[model samples]
Target: MAENKSTSARAASAASSKTEADIQAQIDQLRGDIANLTKLIGDLGSEKASQARARAEKLRDDATKAGQEAYDRARDEALSMEEDLEDRIRMKPLQSILIAAGVGFLAALFTRR
Candidate 1:
């Protein structure tokens, strides 16, 4: 009877040790998985930030190009108007001077009030 009890005790101890080792291995594996997941999330965030910056730069460049085009069109229209006025004045200098004097007199009259 004593021999049988000793064999059973040894068997129980070995089983307990194996169970503890398995539990420890599983815990280590879970820690490694969590670390890998954290790193993946960080990488994804960086990629998104880079994409956003590129989009913003493209929008800025497009806006600048549009503004320059508008300015050039306005400048051309103003030059055309200036040339037309100069040609009309040269065609009739005396009439242009009389019109200018009338406009100045009206302006002075309004300012006096």
Candidate 2:
């Protein structure tokens, strides 16, 4: 009976140690999983920020291209109008002078108020 009691005590101690080891392993695994999940979430956020930055850069490029195109078209139209005005002025200098004076007078009149 004494031998049996010693054997039983050893068995219980072994079982307790194993249980403690298993619980520690579970805690360590949970910590590792949490670390991995945190890293994955951070990586996902960085990827999204990169994608958004790329989109914003593309939009800026598009806007710059559109602005240049509009500027070019407006410049061409202005040049054409200037050529036409020059031709008309050469054909009738006196009439052009009279028109200019009339415009100046009107501008002065509006400014006086």
Candidate 3:
């Protein structure tokens, strides 16, 4: 009976020690995983920041291009309107001059005779 109890105690001690070692190994593995995860998160954050900066630069460039295009279109439209007005004035110069002369002559006649 004494020998049997001694053997049983030894077996229990061995099992408990193995369990403790397994728990320790798992803890170590978890620590390593945590470190790797932290590094990956940091890398992702840096990549995200760089991407954001690139996007901002692209947006700024796009806005500048759009503004320039709008300015050019407006300038062209203004020049076209000026040209159209000039052409109309040139086409009717004789009629405009005659009308002005008639108005002036009537005013003079009314004032003098």
Candidate 4:
């Protein structure tokens, strides 16, 4: 009877030790998994942030290009109109002088305080 009890006690101790070891192994695995997941999340966040920056830079460049194009068009139109005005004035010098004087007089009158 005493030997039976001793054998049962030994069996229980062995099972307890195995359970503790298994639980420790599971805890270690969980810690490793948590660390890996944390790293993955950080990497994903950095990649997304980099993508956003690239998109923003592209948008800024596009806007700058569009603004430059508009400026060029406006400059071209202004130069063409100036040439046309010069030709008209050259063809009718006296009329152009009179019209300019009249516009200046009217502007002076309008700006009077």
Which one wins on lDDT? 2
lDDT of 2 at 54: 100
Name the TM-score of candidate 2. 0.88
Relative to the true structure, candidate 3 reaches a TM of: 0.57
Q: lDDT per prediction?
A: 0.99, 1.00, 0.97, 0.99
Instruction: State every prediction's TM-score relative to the real structure.
Output: 0.86, 0.88, 0.57, 0.93
Pairs of colliding residues, candidate 2: none
Collision pairs in model 1: none
Worst 10 residues of 3 by lDDT: 88-97
Candidate 1's error at 82, in angstroms? 1.3
Model 1 residue 91 distance off true place after TM-score fit, in angstroms: 1.6
lDDT (Cα, tens digit) per residue for candidate 2, span 8-95: 9999999999999999999999999999999999999999999999999999999999999999999999999999999999999999
**Considering TM-score, which of the candidate structures 2 and 4 is the better prediction for this target?**
4
Candidate 2 stretches greater than 4 Å from native: none
- Residue 23 local lDDT, model 3: 100
Please rank every candidate by lDDT, starting with the best: 2, 4, 1, 3
Question: Looking at candidate 3, what is the lDDT of residue 82?
Answer: 95
Find the number of clashing residue pairs for candidate 4: 0
Per-residue lDDT tens digits for candidate 1, residues 1-113, read 99999999999999999999999999999999999999999999999999999999999999999999999999999999999999999999999999999999999999999
After superposition on all C-alphas, the RMSD of every candidate to the true structure, in Å, is 1.7, 1.6, 8.2, 1.1
Clashing residue pairs in candidate 3 (N, C-alpha, C atoms within 3 angstroms): none
- Number of backbone collisions per candidate, in order? 0, 0, 0, 0
